[model samples]
Target: MLEQKHMALLEEAERRAIAPTDNIRACFELLALTGAIDRDCAVRLARHRLSEGKFVLLFLLHDKPDGLSPHELAERAGVTRATITGLLDGLERDGFIARRGGLEDRRKIAVALTEVGRQMARELFSEHTQWVASLFEGFTADERKTLHELLQRIWRNLDAGKQQTGQTADARA
Candidate 1:
């Protein structure tokens, strides 16, 4: 169910022969929902002086006490090494993380969370879990499972389209 304004826009597009099909409308709604979620998440992180990238880095480091290399982090985060480097710089400056020689390979560097970072991750994970769970509060367990399956189907469709078009995941970037 779209908002009144969105419905009106869709109707207008159809009237003008813009061909606003059901698939397009569904895509639009998905984008709008994701945008709202992103905004809300940003606001929540802002309260703790953290960005999404920094939070993700902290979350990853929190689970792996031994830490990860910059390349590994970038791959896991689905970001570029340069992006990870920038995030690490800010986290290190804020005393949230430290870069030290790798345990097994002294030549390589590992990014580990500081004690402060660990504490922050613990606190944020608690609040974040609750907030995320709240988003699906209206759905029953079966509905949640169905939604997950539907979302996975949509993702597969997207992947198929990308493959057919010879477009890599990072092409949009």
Candidate 2:
């Protein structure tokens, strides 16, 4: 009762459906692929955010309105305070960010992006949008929509599974 194309797609989906070890490997592989892409993009963008700075800032700011101190940023980013110190220096020098002395504790330095930095962040975000658009360029609108929904569901299921198991899906790896 199914069309040939539909049957073929179903078969392919079955073939590629997340299996035991493949799930962990696939996640790691995806991270690796993204790492490679980020490495290349860092050079192309000449931006630290494209490389590592943005991720550090994002994680720190995710739960707080005020940005993280340099020490906090370095800790979250898994770098030394000295490294963050230099990174902040470069960022501030480029007019991409501004730092303020802590209100109650002047010893602490709070870091945040300036207007120019936010604009750069917007531009970086657009780069991702463009990349995603190009990735699905061959897909129809319906297919793209379906794929997005399916991926979201898969991610949710994976997170739920991890929570329940208390072990990484890495056992399958």
Candidate 3:
């Protein structure tokens, strides 16, 4: 009825008996939209020889000159240690990242981007920024701001729920 793919999908989902509650329907819509955005972005990055996780790691490291530990990267990426380790390995192999001895202990490893990594990160991040901007070209500045605030609020609510359930609420992903 809304003449939108997301709304149409939600309607179809409801017809198929996927919990008709507004909250659940909203969740489905968000998931559909997010998944499509993520998929398209991933393909775009893949053409540039990057994975979604690696792109995220590069951006994260770009913000922190001091770098982060593997544990920290895992937490920030909302991924498992094994997954982070694999991503690091691939990036490192491509000369995009390097692991050095931690300051506290020789046995501890500190993960960071190499010089080449920094250059690539900057280039890739610029492209990524432009690509994402194009997706929201129709949105006014106020609309974009409102969308961000609403999403942030949703994240905070989910994080609060997690905390209430005695779970660690490392909410950024």
Better structure of 2 and 3 per lDDT: 3
Poorest lDDT segment (10 consecutive residues) of candidate 3: 164-173
List residue ranges in candidate 3 displaced over 4 A.
1-31, 63-66, 145-173
Instruction: Please give, for residues 1-173, the per-residue lDDT of candidate 3 as tens digits.
Output: 13266677767777888666587666766787788888899899888678999989998898777679999999999999999999999999989888998887889888889999899899988888999889998999999999999987676568575666555635433
TM-score ranking, best first: 1, 3, 2
Q: For residues 146-170, what per-residue lDDT tens digits would candidate 2 score against the true structure?
A: 9789766666567675676665667
Q: Estimate each model's TM-score.
A: 0.78, 0.49, 0.66
User: Of the candidates numbered 1 and 2, which has the greater TM-score value?
Assistant: 1
lDDT (C-alpha) at residue 137 in model 2: 76
Best by lDDT: 1
- Candidate 1 regions with alpha-carbon error over 4 angstroms: 1-12, 18-22, 159-173
Q: Which stretches of candidate 2 lie over 4 Å from their true place?
A: 1-36, 47-50, 54-66, 136-173
- Number of the top candidate by TM-score? 1
What TM-score would candidate 1 get against the native?
A: 0.78
**Model 3 quality (TM-score):** 0.66
List the pairs of residues colliding in candidate 3: none
Model 1: how far residue 47 lies from native, Å: 1.4
